[model samples]
Target chain A: MMRLLKIVLLVCLFFGCDKKAERPSAFLQTQQIKLAPPRVLTTSTIIDSSIVLSADFKMEDVKLRYTFDGTDPTENALSYKNPIQITEAGTYSFKAFHPEWTPSETTTVKIYQKGMDTIAIQLRTKASIKYPGMGAKGLVDHKKASLSFTDAEWIGFDTIAKARIDFGKKVHLEKITMAYLVDTGSWIFPPENVIVYLNKTDSIRVQIPNLKSDTLALADVEIPIEKTVQYLTIHVQNLKELPEWHPGKGLKAWLFMDEWIFN
Target chain B: MSYNRRSFLKQSSLATLGLLSGPFYASAFSSNNNKDVIIGHNSHRYKVDLGWGMLDPSKTPVNDCHEMVQDSKGRIILLTNHIKNNVIVYDKSGKLLETWGTEYPGAHGLTLVKENGTDFLLISDFERNQIIKTTIEGRPVLTMDYPKETGLYTTKNSFRPTETAVSSNGDIYVADGYGEQHIIHYDGKGQLLNVFGGRGEGEEQFLNAHGICFDNRDVHNPSLLITARELNQLKRFTLDGKFIETINVPGALICRPVIHKSEIYFAVLRSKNSSDFDSGFVLIMNEKNEVVSCPGATAPAYQKGELQELYQTVRLFQHPHDVCIDDDENMYVAQWNSGQTYPIKLTRV
Candidate 1:
């Protein structure tokens, strides 16, 4: 009876005292990693006489540094006082650094001037209601999506979109880049196959895959046309059916696109 | 009832490892300010109090302060997902009264219902896929597993209950907000009465129907107000599941509908866009459903009966889930996925 009573008392004591169950250590694990590179938002269109660019960071105390030379921007580089103005054709870089946070990587932007003039812009299929452009005039609006998927600046297609950018004046163009948004959960996927037209004769069809990422991604893909094109047109074919793992599987996917950048 | 702490802990640990597995970070803030920030607009302005419920997290940790409710005894009851102490009861002055509960790993919703002058809690566990009814002292009187009889859920995981609303006559309406977006209505006996509202963008359909509650402002003519967070609208439905009208509060991802006096309030989970993380505010709507004030966001504006795009102005909260208004009209906010922080108090000025 005495031994049983002691065991019972011990069990009661054990039950009475409860220790705190901290969050899993793996969740609280901290790492010293470099911060994300500073974002650069250039003028609406880079094909201008002079290009203007801006750089900013979330932290108020973080100082921005930049360099127009080929050297990487560092703490010792010229401190950013105002928006950068580039007149000559060259690439410029910028970076941000703070004492506590990890220093951001060097971000570079190139300046270019295009001589071709677009005479007409028409859509093969009109964009949907929520993401329609300014009635095709938005194609040459000189505004691009600034890392925002739902920025109201891009035009989205329900399944597919086809537009022709009639550059009346022919110029030497080797590559064409298109800005697209990838957020699979929102039923927004990238173009599956892109067919580009050069001078109404030569055409190139390039297949693009769905970007496998959970967070929002502002991605760009370039197709090497490798020719001095006259009339340029683009055909964005959205994903016919989403993958089985996706919640909206078998449903038609959407494609969001901003200005079709010309290079 | 004797406290079988060992058995509770043993079962809680085992169930937590399986049902509530996730990585969570707990934030630590230094005690400093008395009242440096004041939020809200017009007559609803309030002085902020960050130290309202600052407890030793080592002993009482919270994983998503999902909801808050004030009982008749004037004790502030907070429901969190942390199984170690799922329910933390505190006085209005932020004094710790007692802590109990270890079964709710996905403890998301909390509704304090008064029955025969006695108070009970309805906690919706999204992870375990169950809704629990317990006494004031943490005694489980009713355990409602997935409503298999409703015919809405074919599999158990498809019924993720996020919030519940108990009618005056004891009818429990569980919003499967995180599930297939159906509001399962049940009687006091836990028998299914009806099921309505599914996944669609129409007036009757819901996209992330996160919250549901009976708006008894008229007392005689009460209706259900449901939240379509993605659509940024609060939908009013007849008690029998018919869509009546819609209240559009653009750019505000409003959560559950909370009523105190004549005005209705809810924590805007996010604003401007659904993908914008940690951007949240609080909105107060008058009896006409016109937003009177928006706490932490731009002032409520309406031009030609269309609300302008509203976004956060003062960064006061991150992903606020629900708001509880005390008898003194003081506001207490609970947050979700906010680094394991406690509820913030806003004393009305």
Candidate 2:
């Protein structure tokens, strides 16, 4: 009887230990590091249009490094903490390194000719980002691109109106030129019913007439400044409506301004 | 109840092998008697460019298409979730004709029905957790919220209705796919008729009751329902909610099935490891509950790793989300989350 009891006890012990082993323990070591926001650096001058870039996780104890040219980023290359100047007007790729993890990487920006003064812009909601000629394809990288300006800038309005630019500073009076980037044969979203105003009054607003490729170049509408105007207002009325041949059924609005030349 | 890990693996493996065997291949290639059966690889070549006329000239072409149906006038309508706009209409030649339904932020399932010579569209909104019907021109005709009459659902928008099936008499069967795991039925006028199945491992239950269709071929007692039980195999049921029998196409992750002229053709989303070029296959089932042929068949045994290299020609499927057979026995398939979300047509040669 005692031998039988011992066998039963051994089996019970085996099964009990097995159950305990199979149970997943809450003390399993786990570490989660939230990704850091993308780093962006730009020069105070518009001519030197290169922007330094890096991304580093603050929680992790790893050294971050980046490179500007097509070469690999080394210790001598710009560090994550320092601002790297982008002097050239070409596409530059950058890579950020962290030990024991996949490298957080980003593409180089395409620098355009400085046309106007930089006006800071922030999206109230998640705005649809896009390139001027390429529809919807280049919008995915909007978060990485810097739409904010750091210096005082002048913007001309056809009339006096309330204009709000994110992180923007108002400068002295200046003549303004408004040129719409139009891709003649290519398609664009939020089709041309935009009204430009100097002030909030509708009397100063001018309607942009629709022009096709055969009739006008994609850079079609250019409004020349006659007076030194301040407080520029752009009224994107009929923003909810899509183009006549709009292949998609949705609502999206965007403001694309290149250079705001300051006097 | 505890989920059975061992039994689940064993059943799943057996089902997979059973589906991948020669019998399933045979059924996929052959027509069940006189019924016309056409099968081909679900191609990922066509894409719907949603930026055809938008103001933002930077939109990418839509790539992931979930469901497809032909309209009364033979225009191919695609239900996609690649971008904000869910539904897109195209001509049979894969040209973008028109598009709409951006309001449904999460559109998943799309089925077209022509009643009284007017084309009607039924869509399953995944985010909204509702089923809606509209006209061909994108007008909201009727919207069916979660049936409050059915006391089974616990959450407010619990019914994530996916693919839908319509009977000759206009009865609608909605497979509550990503939600409460129930198949809800409604009359032609949108009255809640019945509800069956829930989240369970039992024979009659389902893990993800993805798609449903009405089998009206049998005249005497037309089977009221058929479903793609994602985990528990395929199931057929009576209109009164009685479980009849189970059909197993093991290892085959089936997305949807359609019956045309007494033959059953099922769309199998190519297994992740499969080297088949078509990312999916069509299985033809005979009355004896056996697979007669597998159209677009791959080799019985190619070195497993070698399949991926020959993926382009290997009768493989990417993610065949839905299938429909037209009156001319032409097979139409729509793949989800692919590089190109367009319908692939296969004519019975």
Candidate 3:
């Protein structure tokens, strides 16, 4: 009887152990790891060195730590907020860590000093006009009808009047276009007055003669050309200001322009 | 100015009709060698399907169908731009067999030649701005950078060579399409022979002179120069920097042209509207100097509310940037802005 009981006990124990092993446990443990380093933007050559580094993580409240020289990363390193800039020539190392997660790995990059890389600049033209009749508000305001340059140092434009623009420096101009949003029941007459200034210096103002308000029209213009100009001015001279135009009830204008090519 | 739809369509149709009946069309389609030629007026129809064979998984590494050349084994090897997946080898039936060239970035132009019983592939890399010669299996045999030793390129490393043409005696010509707008000639072993053309609007000048092919059909003086000027027209030139003639193709923005079986097929983008956006067309000109068949001709139309609704008509093309004709006369068109973004095959009816 005792031998049979012992055999049964051994079988029961074996089955019980197998069942326990098969059943999935409620509490699971995982070891998550990340291998990718932070993104680093460097110049084409190491000679003219400028590095921009950024680290982004999904974990909550993670802190990024970085060092300029080659060294072992520590927890008390300087934190990173925006993209870190490196102008000097040397090696850079970075790391990140979180309180509730594994420490982010380290990465290294090299930077070198170089000369001035040639930057190609392209200038585009944007010109438009707005008119408000007598006892009406003005058409487009001056501030909204301005042009924005990508590299302002390479080129500059001064608004001579509400309609004129002055160009500075010689640059290869590739394309010119205009964009405007007009109100309902408004129109623009003689759309051909949009001219470009060919020579350098002096403000070129746009003059709008015989202008009216309260009509709708498609004020988009595009001229395909490639030319070299040292100075350029956009003239919007034919606009007629109205006496009834006030600050709150004047013609509102909006213009947007882009895509310039200069070699 | 008020938008006049009826007048615009009438004027444009007349202009197109006038262009289709030009002198080049007269000579290109006529037969003089006792060969029977069938000329059809308005015989070519326009048809368009916005969603035809364009359905592939996004980011699928499909091989580019740049230029097609026949191999010794009667297979069609495609010289791809290598921008997506380079160097797709296809059969004559448009079947994708095997592909190579993920390593060569910006592979723009391709040409194939057989010399000494060995087949070689010539590739132009726009990013590297150099010409590379490789074996059929993608092994680099010779690589030529900007011919600085020839003192041709005024700008250093600015030669963005596009396509190539080879002569019977193994002279190679490279078209600098993107960079200098010049043609560089070389020997079989990649030695710089000479260079011509520059950035100008003159007779020998080129704006975006994209493609070149050897015209060997003329028996008397077989000139070896052809160019696809993107803005203006197609130009024929002598091998030695001489302008032979200019073929005017109005209302068509040409991209590339290739010759097959004594016929010339040029890819063109026709603006559907006066808005200057690209609708596509392909023109087939025979030796007699007439457009015997025009495939994928599209008309421009403005949509009621769509932002520039340029309708592609029957046989209408959507930016047919490059075209190739197989041995069976089936047309393969590579588009830049078609919804499919893959090469479309049009079987001849």
- Judging by TM-score against the true structure, name the best candidate: 1
Evaluated on chain B only, candidate 1 has a TM-score of: 0.88
- Candidate achieving higher TM-score, 1 or 2: 1
Give the alpha carbon lDDT tens digit for every residue of A1-263 in model 2.
21232233234333432332442211100110111112333442234344443332332333555554556555456666655555654333444443322233342333333443444432223222223222222211121122221111211121111233321444443333332322211222222444445445532444555432111111212344444444455443322433443332243322333333323
Candidate 2 is scored at a TM of: 0.45
- Candidate 1 on B182-263: residue-level lDDT in tens? 9888998788898899988999989888888878898988999999887898999988889999989888988899988899
Can you give the DockQ of every candidate in the order shown?
0.05, 0.01, 0.01
Which candidate tops DockQ? 1
The candidate scoring highest on lDDT is 1
Worst 10-residue lDDT window, candidate 2 chain A: A26-35
Tens-place lDDT per residue, model 3, B1-349, is 1221111111121122122322222222121211111111143322222222232334434333345566677666665554455776667655666667776665767777788998988888867878889898888888988878767666556888877888777888888887778888898888877888776777777877778877888867766545545544678888766888776554555666677877777776553222223345676666754455555332222244222222222222345667766666666677643332456555554
Question: lDDT for every model?
Answer: 0.72, 0.48, 0.49
Residue A244 miss distance in model 2 (angstroms): 39
Candidate 3 local lDDT, residue A3: 24
Tens-place lDDT per residue, model 1, A1-263, is 21232233234233421234222121101111233346567784345667777875534356889888767887899998677776765567887675533355576765444423454778988788877755566555555665455677777788678887766776778777776777665677788999987745688888986655333556667788777756777788988887766666788888888666666
List iRMS (one decimal) for every candidate. 18.8, 29.3, 35.9
Clashes of each: 0, 62, 46
**Predicted candidate 2 versus true structure: per-residue lDDT over B174-285, tens digit per residue:** 8887777788889978999889877776767877777777787787777754554456267888876788987765545566666667777666654322322233554555
Estimate, for each residue in A1-263, the C-alpha lDDT of model 3 and write its tens digit: 21232233234334432332443111100111121234333432133345565644322355667787777467887777777666675556666564422354465554434321232222233232222111001121111121112211111111212222222445565654443333222222223235655556533333323223332222334444366655444543222222133221333322222211122
Model 1 DockQ class? incorrect
